[model samples]
Target: MEGEINRSVHPIFTRDPEDFMQYLNKQVSVLKEDGKEVTGWVYTIDPVSESFVLLSFTDDKTQLDIVMGPSVRQVSVLDENSETYKKRIEAMFRPPEVEALSEEELEKRKNVLKSWLLKNRLPVQVAGNNGELLSISDALFIEPPYGVENCRSTNEIILGRIQGLIKNMPSDQEEWC
Candidate 1:
């Protein structure tokens, strides 16, 4: 269940990419079975270890601020010097030495996790007033298998603010944006 917008920026609670990757793979598997929509990928600071990751959203860039206690601002979104870009390119070329999980095994593991997530996860509504496929900013993906509570709070906040912004604007003004 989602709630109304909170315009203030929320503090980033955490930034554990490996944990996110596992959860994503699992969620994707189960969602695909039931034909649910989700965006999934492995995000890494070291592209050299991860492999075969096709780079999408190269044009994507946004400021990320982790404000749980202190303000650690991060420039999120993918770029040439961005972590995603670095890992993806290195992942593309990294050979047999640094593979984390076998592709087949990773897929299987994801299936199991997806099944579990489908059972325990809570629904957090995310919508874009501009009515776009990628308009979601913040959504509470119920704590995953390992109790990672704020897995996506940062993104959810950004998307939620955008939604709030769109809702208050005039129809014609929306198109001009």
Candidate 2:
């Protein structure tokens, strides 16, 4: 909840797309005008209309819900899972591979990946910079992959490590010191 926004007070509908995009890919507890609460990972925000695309996973199925901006009363970020969620969203709608993509196409993909990682506060190390790693507290460094399948496997491994870490962490009361 580091950067929680109270939409009732701030009027998110009137905010710019850059502001709305801040909530993208993070786990959030959203309160609607009708008083109903919904929790999910933010997938994206429509710049034109400021609507939120949220993703919720249950069992084997994944559900995507769109909450209109005007109806949102508040949005409280639950956790920072933006990087993982972004990867999930990308995998869902990724375009088929072309035999030979142009330089511009590669650059575009790189920029998109870099932007998402930076926005999510995920640590990243450029592939060809002598392989020198950059470390951030409580952050994991995932190597850039060559293809979609490799990226998916890397994500799964990272997720598994995260789950294991969560399971081993001290409880709230124990960390009060």
RMSD of each: 22.1, 18.6
The residue-by-residue lDDT of candidate 2 on 1-177, one tens digit each, is 879876574444565667776787798888999999888898778776567888987779998888887888898999886776676665675444422455455545444444445555666444533332222232443222222222322355675654344344344412311
Error of 2 at 93 (Å): 1.4
**What would the TM-scores of all predictions be?**
0.22, 0.47
Worst 10 residues of 1 by lDDT: 63-72
Candidate 2 CA-lDDT value: 0.59
lDDT of 1 by residue, 9-29 (tens): 432334444533442111111
Alpha carbon lDDT of each predicted model:
0.32, 0.59
C-alpha lDDT of residue 61 in model 1: 42
Off by over 4 Å in 1: 1-98, 121-150, 155-177
lDDT of 1 at 132: 13
